[model samples]
Target: MTRLTATAENQSLCTLSRDGSACSTAKYHEGAIAALAQARRALTAAEPGADPDDPIRAVRARWVGQAGAGTTGAAWRAYLEGGRDGLDILLAPAGTSTGPAAGTPPSATGPTAAGERAPGPASRVLVGSAAAGRLGGGRWPRRRVTATAVLTPALFAVLVAAGGGFPAAAPWTVLVALVAVAAAATLATYLPGPGKGRRPALGCSPCAAMAAMTVLAAAWFLQAAPHQPSMAAAALAAVGFGLLQRLTQTDASCAS
Candidate 1:
């Protein structure tokens, strides 16, 4: 065994196999590829009937062409996703230091046997930092839709309870409808984003319209003291809005 002499320059020790076959370094790989490419180009430019024993021809046909074929998918995956405990640094070239590289945040995720670390608790949390703080690809959109859908009905329910103006004080139907609408809106989130080509099955328009008409009907009923042409007309504007949305939204649009 060779004792590694750690210097100010070389902060970490590296070990080599007895046969010196497993030299995993980005620079070495890059140099190998570049040399291979240059050699292949030279060989291709050579005369058609070159010597059969030409070293360049042998190298190209044997090593360069077969480099990736020998690498399994598992190896590629391991190489791409090195473990968090300075494993990638361990795999890097001799001259490169793995200590505190710029822009690469230190990993709190402990190393796994495999290079890829499993998702941590932070990744699993629904309202965690990443989910809430990410500019895109977060749970914010889902949360927003949920808050709006749920709050709209809740507010209307509160209004009805306070005034006793709208359709009798049975909150089950309205609450149930809101729950269903909220569920549909959530399902719609799994579909593609809005305004593309496909419209969502659970349209937010209907929910918004329902919430609005409920409030309006309650107020109208109170003002009329149970005397009105029809509460159905109270929903006409919402119905129109929903119809307009149906005309414009694509089938895949998750406008919940």
Candidate 2:
């Protein structure tokens, strides 16, 4: 009885092995059929004028099937290399005619390989002129805007200090100040958010300095106020605000 049970177990193992092999073979053949169908569709789409008997077309079809089967790293590299060789065949002079033939190269009167349509002398000159105009027009304004943004504020500040009073420099100073503020805002918007468990607030030394100067300028503007603060008081307020901004950033980072 023990020997008979052992024999039965051996037969069951053989049957399972045979079934697994058959399933694997069926899957492989299904994949091959799908790949072949895809290759036929792609070859027809890529070159409508190509000959059915063309050797290059046959090579490309084979590559399309293999690629569809999901070739991997090294296999993919080899497939691409083979595909390029196939393209070369199709593009070679022997595969094409310049005259009245199915694979004929386009005439000089037609589009070039660069896809430029046949152009008359006048049209060519117009295209060149338009391209040049676009190039110069776009670049010059950008350079001018950048130079003005950087230089205008510094120069205005110097002029105001040299004048020894805020009223005399108020107009130009205000204009430059507003421009600087807008630029700072734009830059802050694009900056990356602080890391997780870090600060959400943005801070810049230059911005802090600008805020301090603005406070001073505002005090000067309000010199005629019925109750005006002293210069020392104004300076202290500026320093307090700067410190507050820094502390707030630290607290936010800790919370995160």
Question: For residues 39-93, what per-residue lDDT tens digits would candidate 1 score against the true structure?
Answer: 4344455576664225344443543343365544432222223222222322233
Kindly provide the TM-score of model 1 when superposed on the true structure, using C-alpha atoms: 0.21
**Model 1 alpha-carbon drift over 4 Å, by segment:** 1-141, 158-233, 236-247, 250-256
TM-score of 2: 0.17
Candidate 2 lDDT over residue span 124-149, tens digit each: 33333343333222222343346446
Give me the candidate number with maximum lDDT.
2
After superposing candidate 2 on the true structure, give the runs of residues whose Cα lies further than 4 Å from its correct spot.
Answer: 1-19, 53-256
Please estimate how well model 2 matches the true structure, expressed as its whole-model Cα lDDT. 0.34
Reference-based lDDT, residue 183, model 2: 34
TM-score list, all predictions: 0.21, 0.17
